[model samples]
Target: MKGAMKALRLHKTTQKIVDGLKLETVPIPEIGPRDVLIDIKATGLCGSDIHFIDGSSILPKFPTILGHETAGIICEVGSEVKDYKVGDRVCANFATPCGKCYQCLTGRPSICPNRSMIGVTDDGAYAEYVKTASSALIRLPDNIPFDQGAAATDAVATPFHMISKRSGMKPGDTVAVFGLGGLGIHAVEIARMYGAGMIIGVDVDDYICERAKKLFGADEVINSRKIDAVAEIKRITGDGVDISLEVVGVPESQLQAVNCLRPGGRALMGGLGAAPVAMPNTGIFVRREWEVLGCYAFENLEIEKVLKLASAGRLDLSKTVTSHIKLEDISVGLQDLHQKKGYPIRIVAVQD
Candidate 1:
């Protein structure tokens, strides 16, 4: 605790993600009297982290330690820290809410007016140790491994946030999931569990599409690249899918999902992409009363759902967790992640 711990800091001079970064003699961060010091167990690589490397996050500035989907063990606690103590395995939620805000007062803390996210609005994990508010720490079940907890934050949680919260998919509903990557594949699984009559998986990779059904138990899979994905989906569902979850943030996929909707279909568009494209206004007005939704990060974040899903064996935890690397190998991990050779769901960076 007295000596400095290793950390990867985004270099300010060249705006680059330099690995083997060090904080040779950094201080143990001061507790806010309500914060707890966490001995970071593992951190997951997110597409957003690549944005930080490419200098494209909407976040204000750089020189930040970049990681959000992280889990750790509590090493120290401030006087005001309650319900948590040293040695508790926990994960951090990105949306830190101010209790006094109008949103928080109305039981909507996720959309709190004064929200500051780690890794973007503040310094974050990607270090040996980090500090977070006691309110942010959700204890990990003893049965869960840190490596599994690492990817639980978003890769697993985002689908729950979208399918249930944004899309409002219910039992007996028919759902369409576009772009069967980390979030999309998970969404398909959730759709199946939610008792959707038909779960359609759409992706450019036939391998990923096939894996969606084989591994996650999705009812049907479609390759958007080979066939007219929208037309095929319409043909399968008679009119269209009841709910379409768009995980690829590419504008074309967004349009394609919307175009493939039945009357009153809900389109849940979620992912990390900035490419622009146009959508037809009348598509919703004429036949389908479609809800063109925009989903970013998870809202009203709950760590338990992701863990519980894994714990209950509902999620394909092992299949989704693709790569594991030590802290020193982070840079190489990021590069390989960008290439995405085999459609690994979560690339976790852990300690030796």
Candidate 2:
């Protein structure tokens, strides 16, 4: 539990790779051209890892390492790497982006035609070391905790992408978010930071509902199982939310997301449910003409914005981290995660 370290890995034919975690004596990663080798300080467990574990995620080749949200210290850099050096604290954005792709050229690298995420197509964190493109690594401030930096990509960056870049949110917009888990909490905080007038947080669990208002700054919290989320949201916002986000992938939540939107509003789906998305036919297009979309991962601008928020201390993300475990307990942690049992604000796999 001390030195070189262990990791949780998956190597199935398809990406629906389960956790085939094992202990091995591996050397520190070597930097490739345009790469930097990092001594991983912290890494966050993500919902996408859940999809991949069940063999339901999009992946390139198999035999990949898990744990994507990474924060670490630069240990080595390739000869060609620039703007960074050894001893820098860093976090990564594009796990792997094909810079020549059309999507990359358009400054929408999140949708890059040939991008591959860590722990999906390639080896990721959950190890003592990780290597990333120098361009993908952003220097982290000393004020950000190692665990928060590890989660910067998921808890901070991705939601910033949805609110600041993708949502086109202006000041005083009303936003409703479905799910009070990690990403849902992030959505709530990010919406508040964007000057949203009212933030409606939703979940089936009453604990989450209570937690939303107390910790995440949600102006209103709803337990969808007992109350009609759509009607309640409309009642609170008085016009339905300008933007409604589904951070939980349950079929019921998805259905409620469509109804939660005001006419001509937008519905953004950021959760991963491992099932096909189904929406009403005439009810959506004919009645409201609402816009429905999905966002995966994030881009550089959002990453920078989130880092600034963390550095300046503008966001209330205190309730998000409820647990931590060393590499030895990763299997137990993964099991708890699979069941959604005792949802943690941030579950970090770290070196002991």
What is the TM-score of each predicted model, taking all chains together? 0.92, 0.92
lDDT of 2 at 51: 71
Tens-digit lDDT string for candidate 1 (168-279): 8778888888888778877877778778889889898878888898988788888888889889988988998888888878888888888888888888878768687447
Off by over 4 Å in 1: 12-25, 283-287, 299-301
Q: Which tens-of-lDDT digit does each residue in 1-352 have in candidate 2?
A: 1245456566553332233455565655666778888788888877667676666766676656777888888888888987999999888874667889888888888888688666766678877787788888877888987778778777767777777777888898888999888788889888887899889899988987898898778999999889999899988877688898888788788878888888988888887886777577875566788888888778766777787877897864445567788765665676676667796767887753
Once model 1 is optimally superposed onto the true structure by TM-score, how far is the C-alpha of residue 99 displaced, in angstroms?
2.4
Best by lDDT: 2
Q: After superposition, how far is residue 127 of candidate 2 from its true place, in Å?
A: 0.7
Off by over 4 Å in 2: 1-5, 13-19
* lDDT against the true structure, each candidate: 0.76, 0.77
- What are the RMSDs of all candidates, in order? 2.4, 2.8
**Span of ten consecutive residues with least summed lDDT in model 2:** 11-20
